[model samples]
Target: MKIRPKVTARALAVLGLGALVLSQAACASPTEPGAATTASAAGGFDYTDARGDTVTLDTVPHNIVMSEQAAAALIPYGIRPVGIWGSSTPDMSGVLAGLDVSGIESLGVSYGDVDVDKLASLEPDLVITGWYAGGYLGGLGAEDAEVSKQIEQVAPLITVSAQKSASASLDDWRGLAQTLGADVDSGTIADEKSTYDDAVSQLKSALAARPGTTAYAVAPSTQFYVAIPGEFAELIDYAEWGLDVRESPIARDSTSGSFSPVSWENAGDYTSDLLLYDTRAWTTPLAQVERDHPTVATLNAVARGHVVDWTTDATFNYASYTKQIALLTDAVKALPASE
Candidate 1:
């Protein structure tokens, strides 16, 4: 039977391994603090983020606000922001579930639904969001110009790139953590880096033994949107790490978010050795996604039961991806050897 991802206590308990990796990160060896944490004549802290915009802070900017994705990265490093905005209502199934977020203010449930008044009242010094193209692209940042203006006025908004390779994003998060005064070399942050490296190594070893295995990523909803894996940070990292992530049958021109919408009848048009289905909400069972269009079963991966849960919609952070990659490695190990 195909398993559906549910937001239940049991599901979280199964996801606890990732949380364990994060909870143990705080004890790694410490490194020297970055200049951002020390006093400078500039009278504040400054950083050039993924968008290449310079965000300056009057002081160490203690009260922080961010999109839930950014919070996922910062929280494990002990840099808890004061407020968070999620794509949906806060739940225990999210990347931030392992940590206590009760004290963190919730801006709104979905993107474009942020409470500008409540956000401003938080009196935040810095706001972190996801970078798509050249601007903020997640949560409140995804709102209209007026909404963005309202939030920007309250605090400077910095973003990490959501379109870069996962490895790049991981490096950016490490830099961001240090800039935010986190001891990146010590604690859970450092431990996560080590775990991530080991996971990647394991993935590489598995792939090396089966170099021809191909994988395709898809987000299945009422429609099937087959992802061009290279376009996503995580998928790109997987490809570069030696997985045969294939390109899309049809190319789309959108930046950052791009996918080819396929009818169920043609779902098997793009098939591979493995099928990585999106794990976000709205994703139905593998059978249901191909209900009317039985042609999906013709896909090699599907016929061979090679489907795996892909966390493309979840937050991109070392702590999150470390666990994700480890799971992928395990999945690969479980696959039968090619003839």
Candidate 2:
């Protein structure tokens, strides 16, 4: 066989060029051996937040913000965040005490008041914010241009939304944890997840001990609201967490409010085994709920002392969906066992 030096040289040159291209691509891609990727990408973390927004973060975040669904997701990490979002009352205060964030509460911020300054000051490389950004984000330009820029500057943000429908946020909390924690909190994150998993397992056993019982939760803000588990309803999957969480016609009006608003006139129509209240508001005024559509007696939960002060234990964005399952589990257990 005759050897051709010219042809051999061309082949070697082409091979060299291919190597350069591959190296360049590796540099350009977000998914590096130690770097994070998207949900669809290998070692990816594709997540949808409360705002119906989809976002991807490489390798999990270490200094997570413990955004909207803190207890639902981050508390399990045992990271004891420097900051978190909360409601305007004791529910949040009490819930915080149970987790590692006890000292950082003031470091705590609210949904609409995310302390963009605080977040920026922390200068954290990564954050675990929610999809809603608690309305802190989006709808920029004109009036909100300044705050909008401020948020983008608060470090790269990842959005998370939990919903009842397929279009709702993805149940990627564990995946997100696994992804973000891979950086530094891997072992701690795993332990945190195990703790959460164990808590859930215990909750299941507790639930299994009893026969099925219908349950419902209400958050009394300025008005009355209900918490319904959608696609991200981890509580709905509990071992003993029973419920008939059907979407009410009122919910058809997304504008009215979520979890369903209870007017005094219509409170009787929605009674079940129990009714949970945000109580953070009522805790002070101590005013009895005036669900006047029917006398309070008309509602079975009210009749059975099932009406409860539900502040701690639930977790949602801004307590938005704080629908804290562990809190709910404990609360439901506190209920009088129905014979």
Candidate 3:
């Protein structure tokens, strides 16, 4: 869509969060943006986010359709939108409480089928989507045409494609917010970054933190997979910061690089100091998994109380990542000081 040149300039006029506006020269030959800017282009938005092909909104958006789990990340920063996909889980409820949108028209149906008719009815100013493929694509299956048609009709569609890549972690969600023309608070992002760096440092400081201390993660799943925390989980590993440590590379059912299903009969095969678990699987309510195996109640983590629920409310899966990191840091801090 064509944004009025004047409105575009005015939008760039918002005070300062380091949003980069394209000079006529810069716009002519697109180049990779260095970082979330130090001076914002419009409305002090956080990043330039204008790709070779741009989706520029002339002003701070008033009514928006949030169609991905990443929607979880935006609502907290006061982008309280007109419509959002709802969630059924409760552990994630902490993250969802901040949204002030109560009575606006439901802007669009979530990841599942992309109901074109319902989306068009909401009449949103713009639609922001992420991970339609991994999150909702399974259930929707081969109906790509239907999905495309429904999405196109709602508003200008911007695809974040987060699901396509296994990222370092949730920070990727910030990139999406920048693209949406909302410059999220830098202080908030900086605070989160600082907290995260500190947590990792503390974990490294505690002598008990080590690679061999044993660690693994799992989703509250049906056909479960083993979750191996990558460089991301290293925050819990004490080393450069100093504390002896050694964690074996995670070993799971099929070498699939995901959390695995463990039974008490052979659960010992997978032992560790920490067990990270989540239930973000789009299908299969984690509640169902918890109910199906009361036996898991006997696992050492559950029995001794190391087991922690990753999320209660589904909506917060991607919404409150900073808070999520802070919570994760606190949870790790609470672990018994073994060294």
- Residue-wise lDDT of candidate 3 within 79-157, one digit each (tens)? 6555555442212333355555566444333335444555555555555544332233222223255765444434554
Instruction: Give the alpha carbon lDDT tens digit for every residue of 228-318 in model 1.
Output: 7766788988888888887666656453256776666677677887888887776777887656557777888888878888887554666
**lDDT tens readout by residue for model 2, 265-321:** 565567676665555533222134543223546667767766655552344321222
Flag regions of model 1 displaced more than 4 Å: 1-39, 134-136, 141-144, 253-257, 336-339
Off by over 4 Å in 2: 1-72, 75-95, 102-108, 132-148, 164-171, 182-212, 220-242, 251-255, 282-287, 290-294, 307-339
Q: Cα lDDT of all candidates, in order?
A: 0.68, 0.44, 0.43
Alpha-carbon runs more than 4 Å astray in model 3: 1-53, 57-61, 86-95, 107-111, 132-145, 161-212, 220-225, 228-265, 279-300, 312-319, 334-339
Error of 2 at 60 (Å): 7.8
Residue-level lDDT for 274 in candidate 1: 84
Ranking by TM-score: 1, 3, 2
Which 10 consecutive residues of model 1 have the lowest summed lDDT? 20-29
TM-score of each: 0.82, 0.58, 0.58
